[model samples]
Target chain A: MTSNQDHLPTGQPDDGAPRGKVIVSVDAMGSDQGPSVVVAGCARSARSDSDLGFLLHGDSAVLEPLVARQPALTGRCTIVHADETVTMDDKPSHVMRHGKKTSMWSTIGALKSGQAHAAVSCGNTGALMAVSMIQLRRMEGVNRPAIACLWPARGKHGFNTMLDVGADIKAEAEDLLAYAIMGVTYFRNGFGEERPRVGLLNVGTEEHKGRAEIKEAHELIADHAEIGRYEFVGFVEGSDIPSDRVDVIVTDGFTGNIALKTGEGTAKLVADFLRESLKSSALALLGAMLAKGALGKLTARIDPRRVNGGVFLGLNGTVVKSHGSADATGVAAAIGLAAKLAQSGYHGRMAERLVIAAQAVQNAADASAQNGDRS
Target chain B: MTSNQDHLPTGQPDDGAPRGKVIVSVDAMGSDQGPSVVVAGCARSARSDSDLGFLLHGDSAVLEPLVARQPALTGRCTIVHADETVTMDDKPSHVMRHGKKTSMWSTIGALKSGQAHAAVSCGNTGALMAVSMIQLRRMEGVNRPAIACLWPARGKHGFNTMLDVGADIKAEAEDLLAYAIMGVTYFRNGFGEERPRVGLLNVGTEEHKGRAEIKEAHELIADHAEIGRYEFVGFVEGSDIPSDRVDVIVTDGFTGNIALKTGEGTAKLVADFLRESLKSSALALLGAMLAKGALGKLTARIDPRRVNGGVFLGLNGTVVKSHGSADATGVAAAIGLAAKLAQSGYHGRMAERLVIAAQAVQNAADASAQNGDRS
Candidate 1:
């Protein structure tokens, strides 16, 4: 499927010029619905953004044909051949050892080698996380990497950022402090919030409640907030996650993962209940038809497809992991998010902010120690 | 406000007869709505069940005036005056020290002295748990008592039981094993299910996921499932909490509390969205009016007030803690649950089940040790 002729119809008039364009690496394989969705999503994204280019990584034989169908992605796409694919069931360690030739590995490799500004994939979460960590490496002074997802909320931006959604199960107080800084920086960069409010996730909002590590992290986060350019809302409970009370919620991976899934499950249950209720009676069915426009607007506002990517934070390069079962629309949303972060230069800015926040936490620790010695 | 007359109109003809009656001790102060709501709830409960009685503990000046308004609860209620009340902000340690005169203390004391079969309270959770732990004591071999709340689910009973919602922030492997046994016994006794399906709450359903203690607890629970008379469904994710796959979900207090609150917050959010949409346009309002009956049915099925009580498990006596902001309907639901558990003799049967399950776990550990030595 390798095309001898590279030039095809461009949907936009300025697409032929490629100077100062942001290039995103796309893994066009291993999605539950196959590479056609990835090509369609890329084509859709390219139609909307004239300055975006793609380095599509997969089997060129299969991807070239799919990309050929989209006139908008024709002059903008480049296919790199990858012989192997990473299955969803493949272990992360196994992928790290024997996944060099897979599309996921090559896609992230483009970001690591400076050929792409960001990477997007809809493959195995563990394998993608492992590959991203090993290939991209952690930023300087970063102890653990976190995955930050934008949850639909009642905030001004219509979304709130939460971190450590399943990167690792354990976090020390220092790791939690790092999460707070990273979350603040990501939210500000991704959503253009100047002074995001950061909250530590706990069982209770009181300072004295929760585990010892969370309490310590709370104090540390509060101390570093001023230097980090964010407001520290002492402690917030799970109920505050979807509220406008805070812009960023920080927690360890275990709790964050559980809360994330629980929210998704509850949303699905409510939607199911609505559907069943609408079909319960003849009168209800007629009423539903009359109210379809209003209900459709509400559904669009809460639809999971609108916000479809989990951005892996604290790495040298940005990697957005989409849902494995996402269709073209979901994949396009993920690609759009990746392009937005890449354009904002979020990685460099986050690195600079994290260094300052880390120093502030260290200084506070030293000051407390000296006071202890004097007393 | 104390009344000298003891006779009032009986809602039922045989209300004066008190043979084979089950009594529930209720702390009639500290609810957000006041004692009038509690009296109304008790009167509503008495009108429905003739075999139920109440030992009302509060200031007689406040409670007698309210109880006198409910003719159905006139002769069936016995007032025990307690001068103090536990404020919501009161610390548990302070209550244990200076709270003997509080109505919460006297309410639990009634159960401890065998004057009532169970105790119900809508006061401070920390103070109530502290008072119950001190007054009734933990059952033999029980390390930590858990607070189990019935979650709305798709199960046959329409609710699944979840433990350690907020009792304590930590749970050892042994404590988790004890929770498994206690949850099974409580579900079986409360819901009349001969065998309950139990799942260990974790971030994933995989055996290798979650913390170390959870992994160990999983093995122990599996081994003791037969003697415990429950089916061990292994690790379940947070999504399964509202699913029909399991009847009992067990976790540490920290995770369980967060999941519970998150679910509550999300449900409220969806309902808020629906209400906002219905009021968005005149056509939508008309449609909603047409479908009022079906919508009301849906709302009732998911109402938090219908399932308002969180039973304190693994205690020497049964204690039901209602929501602090519960209204008359919520209080009636809590009273109904306390009455059900009291009539079922749940406390004594839970003790017997705990002993057998604990022994089975110990024997399994010994067998594994001997096998290791032989190997």
Candidate 2:
């Protein structure tokens, strides 16, 4: 891959992928569906864009034949053999202490060694985060790394960037400020929303609502909006997430994770109920059959597989965690996100913005300390 | 107003409202739709159940003509005239300090004066809570009052009781335990579920997940479950809110409020998307027309108005807060909930249960404190 290939635009994709040679390392053995699905997903991703490549990490004996069967991945992938694979039940601490040779660890190692611009895994989230943090490490000036996922919303970009979804349980006022800054950049780069509108997630849209931490975070984010290169939409309620009112929604991991799951569960329950209603009578069933294409479109829009990846933000190297139970389509979506981030040089830009934001944070603290002294 | 009226079964209703002659105090002028909708809603409630009556608190000049037009309300409702109405923009503090003569205040006063079994208002939530807290006061062992709402769920009861939705932002371990006890009682009495399973909402279902407060509350709730007459299901994730596995979900006001709104927003967004897809083409439109009845049923199942009330728990007197913008149907649903609680003697039963749970809590705290001293 030449240096020129790195400059190729990924935002306005011509073939649904970056028009550049970008390799995303995959933990082939970590997926619930095993190496076959991982290889198939890689093939599916590569089929669309010939410039895409993969460094598959797993047992060569298992992954070799799997990669070879796919004509699209014939020469587009290389299998990096790993004797161990992280299981769903594997604890993050245990994996960190004794599972260095696991496929997930090897997958992160590829990014560390500059073998792959990005990494994708359908493994245990805790173990993956543990391995990535230990290997790739947090980006400079980041107190904690956050996991960002795209939420389907009423936006021109078709989504909103939501951060700190189960990355860490607690986010203080300062940490929330960092999340806001990072979330802003993530939305701008990922969704091409320049000056993305950011909102602090709270119980109510009112300024007086929520915990003390949330109130302080609201002030900090609002104060630093200009420096963060985003419009501060103040406090937004959970309902505002899917509304077109905001682009980036920032919250602590505890709240963010719950909101994400709650949103998904609600959508699923509604779909299930609608399906049951449609099947109640013969006329309704016939109507369902006639509107099959339209209903299919609706299902596709709300489908979990359509938005399968949660990108690890505030990390030195980009890593996209695909759902462990994800099939080929889900894995392909995760890989596409990783490829897009890699091609756009998201890491360097995010780090640069964080450094500038950190300086502003320092100046604000200094000014506050001086004021406190005077008082 | 016989004591036998309070003992009459409100559950398994033969009619839509409570069987006995239970008078509900309604703030006629508090609704965003004004006094007309409140009168219409009262009429709707009265039309279905001849046993039900109402004390309508507001300007009699404004409410009289509306109530007269609805013949169902003519003899069932008594107009209690009040000069002022609480506006949505009125702060709770202002309402508490200087707005004593408002319709909201008069409505709650009926409960304190024993003129009404339960109070119903579509007023500003903060003002309602403030007036209720000041007028009726918290129950004997209650730390803070919580607002419990019915969530549509996959259960035989067709709903789950979720508490502390914007009642207050903070709920400590003890407060959470109280919520669990209160929520359990509410679910059992309302849903007719014996030993209703209670779950503490967190990011993950794991025991170690979430903040220290949640973990401590988990143990406290588990310890007092037997005394509280509910089964402890341990920690549940946000996705489990509507799942059949849990019948009662306990959380702080902030998280609970967000979860409620998020769930509602997601459902609404999905419905809107489905509607757009249904009208995407002529064939789809024809199918929609044919399946109109089925779709209407589905819409009704997920409709906000169908479950419009949030019952104020832990108070000395029962209060049901309806949506300020609720229409006639929405207000009727709220009145039904208030009537159900009134007939079932929910306040007395809940208070008795809390007394037992409070003793258990006291014992646990003493033991822990003694252990701390020894250590």
Best by TM-score: 2
For each candidate in the order shown, give its overall lDDT on alpha carbons.
Answer: 0.84, 0.85
Query: Backbone clashes per model, in order?
Result: 0, 0
Model 2 docking grade: medium
User: Among all windows of ten consecutive residues in candidate 2 chain A, which has the lowest summed lDDT?
Assistant: A1-10
Which lDDT tens digits does candidate 2 get at residues B21-114? 8899999988887888988888888877677999999998888888889888777889999999898877788899987789999999999998
Estimate the lDDT of model 1.
0.84
In model 2, how large is the Cα lDDT of residue A5?
21
Off by over 4 Å in 2: A1-19, B1-9, B12-19, B373-375
As a TM-score, model 2 comes out at 0.93
- Which candidate gets the maximum DockQ versus the true structure? 2
Each candidate's interface RMSD (Å, one decimal) is: 1.2, 1.1
Q: Tens digits of per-residue lDDT for model 1 on A103-158? A: 99999999999899889999988789899999999997688999988787877777
Model 2 alpha-carbon miss at residue A322, Å = 1.4
Worst 10 residues of 2 chain B by lDDT: B1-10
Q: Model 2, A248-319: lDDT tens per residue?
A: 999998889889989989999999999999999999999999899999989988888877889998888889
TM-score of 1: 0.91
